[model samples]
Target: MAAISEALTLSAGALEVVLAPAIGGSVGAMRWHGIDLMRRLSDDDRDAGNVLGVAMFPMVPYANRIAGNEFDFEGRRWQVLPNNPPERFNVHGSGWKQSWTVARSNAGAATLALEVTGGAEPYSYRAEQAFAVSEKGLSVTMTLTNTGPVAMPFGFGLHPWFDRDRDVTLQFSARRFHLEEPEGVSGDPITLPPELDFAKGGSLPGGWRNNDYGGWTGEAIIRYPSRGAGLRIVADPVFKHLMLYADPTKPCFCLEPQTNASGAFNRGRWNDPDEGVIVLAPGASAAGAVSFAPFALTFPAA
Candidate 1:
């Protein structure tokens, strides 16, 4: 077997992106004007199993937690192990922990591939990731093809760990929200509360929040007041759910563009488009892209 190399670097104009496909296809680093836009990776991150050390990683076949670690589809039940510790349920699918092979690469673009077989995980699919950078920004396209013998549920998302600052602001459109239960499972849908609303883009709150927002308008903007820089986030319509994870005392947090709700697997509402879930027949495929563009943010004098 040909193994993945240690690292691959790509750049265009003022933007640069480093990838470590060998380490679970995670992004090792992303920068703008030599300043990191995503969290920087460390030596521990280079280890294949340390997903938290990654700047960004893909959630495939399905995204987020599945209640009780099991789901039913087409009259069959599938069980997934607890992928994360201190959490009894399986979180995010198996891809982030699996190594990916580089299919192609260049100065400003690259493509990586992972072939996941059944039995090893719930879904057997061929997943691919394409990264391209332009003066405009960095764009990533992720695709997953059902290669198993039966039909199954599918979802995808890009989990990017943005560096948090004291004066960071965020703005996005989401008509509804899925509040999580105590066990980290989504309880029910509700209107956006005052604490959860960011339609006008405000500073990240002083509390912890981990919820999935629906009815996304397909765009978001994040600005760092101190750094006087910002990033524009845009994703294809396949990604209708936006997940924002902010902790009161964390140096970094996540802004994820995902295809479905947090616990779409156990909801059994696969036919509801608003839930963002999709059913793929054998050999069928689904994909979408997420882009990040950095721009100058002019802040007035104190």
Candidate 2:
């Protein structure tokens, strides 16, 4: 494993981004005109290298949870231990907990890479995250390549935490919703209920909302009315699903863009278009980019 002792910074125009390469290739903070676009990672968390406190982090090899911490592929059974303890399942993947090396950096962009071999996990791969900032906003491109000897199922995504402003509103389109099962695992896909639907746009749910929206259109808008700004997320077509986590108890919420559905591996929906799980062969790679563009909102006189 490579070590990156300090966090890298990228700045352009009014946008500034802090990348914590050592902390799971996570973003420490992102600000546009001094207004936080996401939940800012505290200085204490940055010094301690706490990934859970990061504003955003990469999810490579896979995303979300694996039922029973095990799955079968290619006619063979593979098992993995619970990565996130007390949850009873492997949440996210090894990438978010492992250190990444700074591959390249400049004034407005930096790339961090990580290499992993099957240890307690059953997959080996190389992942890279390219972070860049511009006058508009920030962009992150994540790429994952299988380095193992056999074909295996792979997935990747980005988990970003945003401040749940009192008047925050979210908008996106999806074909259906994945029901939430016990332990927060993804259940069956069903008709998106009216309460969970955000087709036209709506505010965050007052109750718990940990579910996945399948058949995502790869675009979303998040408005922070109190801040007088909004963010637009545009992702590559490869990202077919989006996960929304809005626990009313927390001050922040998460909107994740992922290539695979939650529990896709457990369901073995390899050929299913809705699952979005990629079967990568040895030395194969999958890459995608997600861009966040921020704009100021104009309001009428009170």
Candidate 3:
């Protein structure tokens, strides 16, 4: 497969951006935050392999390791291929890390597509990814269509690693929380741990975080205290859930806005039963949208 790349410029008032599209359909670079917003690979950067930003598709459970990495769907046990080597489970989705085909390109936005054939599983999916630079912020959309001959279980999300530093404040709203057990414990839902709540807005005290939350009204605010630049992430009411990860030692934190709870397919713990688990029939298609808006915060510099 040949890799294709393109560049585009979008400006809306003070929000001007230069976007680079990689053949892999990933946003290679986003200029904002007074610098390139996305992390680029460099020889001296030890964490260069990290995914700066990618459109998550088909599914978005943190991983499949919990619950034995096995789930019974339609009376058959479907085992997902483990993507996390040490943890022994599948993660994000098959296509986030997989290279995507660039279908169209221009100076303002690019379209990328990918297909996944279920080989021992019970589902197949085709996804179209589009990234556009706008004065509002960076907008990414992923649409998944099921082409297989049966109802398939699926979810979608975005994994954007934001720069983690002492001067950043991450804030979001949630009325309830779901906690993932530490290693060696069973995957079960626990009450809102005191430290994980973000409804009041505060700083994360640097540590490992692999938890999911429900009851999100589909909105969040991330502020870079030093730059006075803040970002607002909003999802349609249909995608009413979100996930937060603040690993101080990892150099970044993830505020993943998702459609359903983690491991929803296997666990059947859809936050909203009616809007949960996208079951697309053969020849059926499903779509959802999420937006990221950048804004200038008026807080005094610390």
TM-score of 2: 0.97
- Quality of model 1 by C-alpha lDDT: 0.87
lDDT tens digits by residue: candidate 1, 91-207: 889888788998888789889999999884678999999999999999999999999998888999999998888888899989999988877788668998777888988988788
The lDDT values for all models are 0.87, 0.91, 0.60
Clashes of 3: 1
Clashing residue pairs, candidate 3? 8-107
Give the alpha carbon lDDT tens digit for every residue of 5-114 in model 3: 33344554444443333323444444455543434334232124333343222243222233465666666676767655676655665665555666765655666777
Query: What TM-score fits each model?
Result: 0.96, 0.97, 0.82
Spell out the clash pairs found in candidate 1: none
Clashes of each: 0, 0, 1
RMSD of each: 1.7, 1.4, 3.9
Measured with C-alpha atoms, the lDDT of residue 49 in candidate 3 is: 32
Model 2's alpha-carbon lDDT is 0.91
lDDT of 2 by residue, 252-277 (tens): 99999999999898999798978999
**Residue 273's lDDT in candidate 1:** 93
